[model samples]
Target: MKYISTRGSAAALDFEGVTLAGLASDGGLYIPESWPRFSDNEIAEMAGLPYAELAVRIMAPFTAGSLTEEELRGLCHAAYGSFAHDAVTPLVQFDQQHWLLELFHGPTLAFKDVALQLLGRLFENFLSRSDDHLTIVGATSGDTGSAAIDAVAGRERIDIFMLHPEGRVSEVQRRQMTTVLAPNVHNIAIDGSFDDAQAMVKRMFTDPSMATSHGGRFRITAVNSINWARLMAQVVYYFAAALQLGAPQRKIAFSVPTGNFGDVFAGYVAAQMGLPIERLIVATNVNDILHRALSSGDYSAGTVTPTAAPSMDIQVSSNFERLLFDAGGRDGAALAEQMRGFEASKAMQLTNAQREGASALFTSARVTPEEMVKAMRWASDHCGEIIDPHTAIGLYAACSMEIDAAMPIVTLATAHPAKFPDAVSEATGQHPELPARLGNLFEREERFDSLPGTYEAVRDYVAQRATESA
Candidate 1:
C-alpha cells in the first residue's frame, strides 16, 4: 500500500502520508507503487454486498497500514448514512443495453459526494491521532466546491478554502458553494477559468514560501481528485454497477462524463482489479482535451470554452498524468521528463507505449452543444428522463459509440438536473425542481470573497484566516 510520486525523487509514503500530502514535493501526483489486483473468484464473491460493506472490502487494501478493518467500516457507514437513497448510487435502466447510474443521492447532490463525504471523515480520523491541523485548498468548476464544503464544514481540525470561476458557473452552482456559512468554510470567486484556478492551487502546493509564510504551523492538503483517496472511494461504485449487471460472467462498459478524468480512471482501477469491464468511455463537452488526447495522440490544451455543461469546461485534465505514468510502463523518471515539457509548453505527443496501452481499454467522444441538447431531448422524449447537460454529453457518447450491443453500457449521471435548471429546461422543455431538502437554497444569504486570480492574493487571504492550531 505504499505510494510513490510520479516523478522519481520523493520518498515513498504510506496511505496516511499520501492522504495529507496531496502533491509530491517533486511537483508530481502520487500513485500506488503497484496496483492491487483481485482474482475472478474474489470479484464474484462480492456480487450482492451492500454499498458500505462492499466499500470496506474494495478499499481495505489501500488503507491497510493506516486504518484497521473495523475503523474503516465504521467510517464508511457514518459517511454514507446521510445519503438520501438506500442504494447510495442507484441504476436506472434506459433500455436493454443502456443504463444510467444516479450518483447524486448524497447531501450535495453530485457525484463528488460519493467520495468527499468519506474524505472529510478520513481527514478528521488521521488528524485527530496526531496534533496536526489541515488547511484544505481546492479549485472547482462547479460541484466539487459545494460537495467538499458540505463534507468538511465546521468539522474539527480542518479549514477549507475553495475557489471557483466567477460569473462562469450557473446560478445554482454558484449559490451552492456560497450559501454555506460555516465558520471554517471560505469561498472565493477567482477572475479566471478553472484551468487558471487549478494551476494556482498546484503552484501553492509546491511553493516553499507559502509554508514559511504560515511559520510552518499548518499543512495544506487537497480535496481534488489529485488526492488518491478521492479516487479510491470512487472505485467502489464501478464495482457496484458491474455486480448489479452480473459481472465476471458479463462484461460492462462505462461512459463517464469526464472533465478531470478522475471518474473514468476509477473504472480503469476496477479493471486493474480484475472486474469484467468491456471499455471505459471518456465523454467530454466542447472542451475536449481528453477526447483529443485519446482519439489521437495530441495532448495539447487550448483555451477553455464556456458551454451549457460548465463543469466540463476545463482544458487541462489533472488526473490524466496518473494514466500516462501507468501507460508509460511506470517509469517515473521518463514520465517526469515528459510532464515537464508539457508543463512548459502546455502540449506533448503521446508515446507509442502510452498510446497503445491506453487504446486497449479506453475510447472517447467529444459532444457538441447541438448534440448535447439533442441527447437531453432524446432522453426525455424516449425514456421519460430529464437530464443535466453533463449527463446528456455522456448519454450521447454511450448511444453513439461502437460497442457490442449485448454488453450493458452505463452512463455516469454525475449531477442532479435541478443543478442546471436553465439548460435542462431549454433542451427538454421541463424545469426540474430542486429537492425539498434544498428547496430554500435561493433564499439563503450568500457570503464569499471576490479575489483576483493570483497566488499571492489567495495565499495571503488563507494565511490571515486559517487557524494555526486545532
Candidate 2:
C-alpha cells in the first residue's frame, strides 16, 4: 500500500518508506493512498485464529511486498511469544453486552506494547543488515515512553530517547521508562506537559538542518502512533476482537479511551477495511477537545489541563490529520491554514465536511474524574475488573451509551491499573497489583536528563548525545 501525507502535499511513499519516516516532511501523519479491504467472508474465515496469526493475516495486506507473510508471521510469533498472556490481547466478558479488551498483557504493560513490540522487531528485521542506524524520539504522557524503551533498548542499531513531562506521569509509569539502563536508551524529563514534549519532537523533524546520523545514511523514525507500523499493528486487535465476537455475522462497536486519536482511529481504519463495526465511541477525560469538536462541528484547542487521565490531557490530537484527509474537501492549503490557526490562536475553523468525516464513524463523550472513580469501583464490584483511569472513563461512557448488546461493544482497556495506583486504590480500596516482571521497578535508579521547554535546548541535547554516541 502506498502511503500519502495527510496534509496532501508530500510525495506518496510505500510501506517501507513510510515506516522508516514516521512523520512526513510536511509535518503530517502518513495514511494509505487507498485502504486495503477484506470481504466479510474473509473476515469470517479468521475466526479462531491465534492473536499472532490473526495479526499477520490482518496486517499482511498493508505490508504486502515489504515483508512476506511468512516473515511477518515469524516476527509476530516472536514478538508475542514473550507476552504475559497466551492470548496477546485477551477479551474479558465485562458483561454480556460489554467486554474489556485486555491490551496490557505485553512487555510494557500498556496498549502501546501491543504495537511497539512488533514495531521493534520489524525495525530490527528491516534495518539491521543495511549498516544504517536510527534515533527514535518520542513524547509520552505515561505509557508510550516505557513501551518504546522496552522495544528499542539494548538494540545496537537504534538509539531511543523518550521524553515526558517530569511530574506528570505516575511513579510506575516514570519508573518504567527511566529505569531502563541500556546504553542505547535515554529518558528525557521535560519541565512541561506532554504537548511540550510532542512539540519538541515535531520541531526536531521540522528543523531543516537537524541531522541525526553523522554519516547521513542513518535517519530518524518514531515509535509513536505517527509511525505507520505502530498504527498497522494496533489495527490487529480491532479485527481480532470483531472476529471473536462474530463480525460478519454481527457488527461490533469500540469505545476507545484515546489520547492522540491513534487508537480510536485504528478502529476507523478497521471500519474502512470492511469490518462490520457500528459507531466508534470517542471516549475521553476532562481535557476533551475532540469530544467537544464532534458535538459542535467546530474544531478548536484549549489549554490542556491535567486530569486523573494525564495521557489524554493533550489538546492537539495528531491523528486527526488523517480524518481531515478522509473528509476530502480540504486540501494542503486548507489543512495548512487549519494547523497554523490552531498553533497560534489555540483553535481552528473546521469545515462541515471535516466534521462530517469525524462524526460519520465517531461519536464522543467526556467522562469526569468523579465518574472515572465511580466506574472503577462499579466495575470492580460488578465484573471484578479494575481498569486504569483512562480505561475506566471508557467503561463509564460505554455503560451510558445506547450500546447494542448483539453488536458486542468492546472497550479498549488502554493501560494497566498499576500505572495509576493512587487513583485505582482510592476508587477500589485496593492497590492495583503490579506484574511480577515490573516488581522491581520502584527500586530501580532513574537516569534522565531534565531540560526546559525550548526547541534549541532539545536540539542541542539530542545533537550532543548523537556526537557522544558516534
Candidate 3:
C-alpha cells in the first residue's frame, strides 16, 4: 500500500517509508493513498481469532509491500506475548450497553504499548536489513514516554529521547519513564507544557539544520501517533472489541478518551475498512479543542490546562490534520493552505465539506472534572471497577451519547488506574495499587535531564549525545 502526505508535496511512499518518516517533509501527516476495504464475509471470518492472529489479518493490508505475512505474525506474537492478559485488550461489561475495553494489559500499562511494542520491533526489523540507524525523538504527555521506552530500551541500532512536561505528570507517570535506566533511553523533562514539547518535536523533524548538525550520522524518527505505523497497530483493537460484542451484523459505537486524536482516527480507519461502526465518540478533558472543533466547527486551540487527566491536557491535537485532509476530499493542497492559516492564528473554522463529512460518523464530548469523578464513582459503585481519570472521561461520553439500546458502546480504557493513583483515589475513594509486576516502581532510582523547552536546546542535546551507526 502506498501512502501520500496530506500536503501534496512529498513523494508517495510505501508503509516502511511512511513509518520511518513520521511527519511528511511538507509538514503534514501521511495517510494511506487509498483505504483498503473488506467484504462482509471477510469481516465475519475474523471472529474467534486470537488477538495476534486477528492483528495479522487486519494489519496485513497496510504492510502488504513492507512485511510478509509470516514476518508480520512473528512480530505481532513477539510484541504481545508478554502482555498481562491473554485477550491483549480485554472487554469488561460495565452495564447492558456500556462496556470498557481494557488496553493497559501490556508491560507499560497503557494503550500506547499496544502499538509501540510492535513499532520498536518494526524499527529493529527494518534497521537490521540495512545499516541505517534510527534516532527516535518523541514528545509524550504521560504514557507514551514510558511505553515507548519499554518497547525500545536495550534494542540495537536505536536511541530514544523522550520529552515530557516536568512537574506536570503524575508521580507514577514520571517515575515510569525515569526509572528505566537503559543506556539507549534518554529522558528529558521539558520545562513547558506538552504542546510546547510537541511543537518543538515537529519543528525538529523539518528543520534543515537538524539533518546536518549531527554529523549526518543518524536519521530522526518519531514514536508519536504522527507515525502512521502507530495508528495502524491501534486499528486492530476496534475490530477486536466490535467482533466480540457482535459485528459484521450489528454496528458498534466506541468512545475514545482522546488527546492526540490518533486512537479515534484508528476507529475511523476501521469503519472505512467495512467494520460495522455506528459512531466514533471523541472524549476529552478540559482541554477540549477536539470537542469544540466537532461540536461547532470552531477548530481553535486555547491555553493548555492541567487537569486530573494530564495525558488529555493537550490543546493541540496533532492527528486532527489527517481527519481534515480526508474530510476535505483528500485535496492536499487545499488542506495545506487551510492548515497554514491555523498555524499562523491558532484557529480555523471547519469548512462545510469538512464539518459535514465528520458529522456523519463522529461526535465529541468535553467532560468536566465533576463529571469525570462521577463516572469514576459510578464505575466503582455500580460496576465495581476503579478507573483512571482518562477512562472516566471516556465512560462519561459513552454513557451520554444517544445510541441504540442494542448497540454496544465500548469506552477505550487508555491507562491503568494506578498510574494516576491520586486522581482515582480522590474520585472513587479507592486507591488502586500497581500490579505486582510494577509493585516496586516507587523504589526504583530515577534519571533524566531537565531542559528548557526550546527546539535549539533539544536539538543540541540530541546532536551531541545520539550515537552514530556504523
Candidate 4:
C-alpha cells in the first residue's frame, strides 16, 4: 500500500502521508504502487452495509497499516452519519437500463461531501493527536469550496482558504462559500477563471521556500481530489453503484463529467483493481482537453471558456498524472518532459504506448453549452428527470456514445441542480429547491484571506494563517 509519485522523484509514502501530501513534491500526483483487490464475496457482502462500513471495506486495503479495519469503520461512520441521505449515495433508476447515482444529498449538496466529510474527520483525528495545525488551501470552480468549508470550518486544528473564479460560479455557488461565518474558513474571489485559481494553489504548494520559511510549525495540505483520501472515498460509490446494479453479473460503465479528472480517475483506479467495469467514459464541456486527448491523442489546452458548467472549465487536469503513472509507456524523465511541456506550451503529445493505455479502458466525449441545456430539457421532457449542467454533460456524453446493451451505465451526477439554479431552471422549467440546511446561507457573514495570484503571495498568506492562534 505504498504510494509513489508519478514523476518518480519523491520518496514513496504510505496512506496517511499520501493523504496529507496532496500533490507530490515532483509536481506529480501520488498513485498506489499496487492496487488492492476485493474478492467476489467481499463485493457481494457490500449490499446492505452502512455507507461508512462499506467505505472501510473498500478503503482498508489502500490504507494498509495506517488504520485497522475496525478503526477505519468507526471513522467513516462518524463522518457520514451527519450526511442528509440515509443511503449516503442512493441509486435512482432513471430508466430501465440507465440509472443516476444520487450523490448530492450531503451537507454541501455535491458529490464531494461523500469524501470531503470523511477527510475533515480524518484530519481532525490525525492532527489533534500530533498537535500539528494545518493550513488547507483549495481552488474550486463550484462545489469543492462549499464542501471544504462546510467540513473544515470551525475546526480547532485547521484553517482553510478556498479560491474560486470571481464571476464564474453561479450565484448560489458563490453565496454558498461567501456566507459561511466560520473564523477558521476564508474564501477568495479570484479575478480570473478556475484554471487561474488552480494554478495559484499549485504554485503555492510547489514553492520550496514556503516550506523552509514556515519553521515546521505550519503544515499545508489540500481538500481537492488531489488528496488521496478524497479519491479513496470517491472510489467506494463506484463499487457500490456497480454492485447495486449487479456487478459481477452485469458489467457496469460510468460516465463522469471531466474537469480535473479526479472523479473519472477514481473509476479508472477501480478498473485497475479488476472491478468488472465495461467502460470509463470521460465527459466534458467546451473545456475538453481530456476529451480531445482521448479521441485523437492530443493533449492541448484550448481557451478556458466560461460555461454554465464552470466546474469543468479547467485547462490543467491534475489527476491525469496518476493515469499516466499506470499507463506503462514511458520512463519518469519522459513523463516529466511531457508534463513540463504542457505546463509551458499548453500542449503535450501522448506517445503510442500512452495513447494505448487510455484507449484500453477509457472513452472521451465533449458537450457544448447549448447541448448541455438541451439535454437537460430532453432528459426531463422525455424521462421527467432534471439534471444539473455538469450532470447534463455527463448524461449527454453517455447517451451520445454508441449504446451497448451488454452493460448498464451509471452517469456520475456530480452536483445538485440547485447549485446552478439559473441553468437548471432555464432548462427544466422548474427551479430546484435547496435543502433546508442551506436556507439561511445568505444570512451568514464569511471570513477569508485574499491575495494576488502568485506563488509568493499565496505562500505568505498561508504562512500568516498558520501562525494564527485558534
User: What are the lDDT figures for the candidates, one per model?
Assistant: 0.93, 0.86, 0.93, 0.83
Model 3: what TM-score?
0.99
Off by over 4 Å in 3: 467-470
Tens digit per residue, CA lDDT, model 2, 94-113? 88899999999988889999
Candidate 3 per-residue C-alpha lDDT over 210-265 given as tens digits, one digit per residue, 9 for 90 to 100: 88776666788999999999999999999999999888988999999999999999
lDDT of 4 by residue, 24-115 (tens): 88887788877888767767777777777878888889987787787788888988898788888888776766778888988888899889
For residues 274-361, could you state the per-residue lDDT of candidate 1 as single tens digits? 8989899999998999999998989999999999999999999999999998887998899989999999999999999999999999
The TM-score of candidate 2 is: 0.97
Candidate 3 has an lDDT of 0.93
Q: Which residue pairs show backbone clashes in model 1?
A: none
Kindly report the root-mean-square deviation of model 3 from the true structure over all alpha carbons. Answer: 1.0
lDDT of 1 at 95: 89
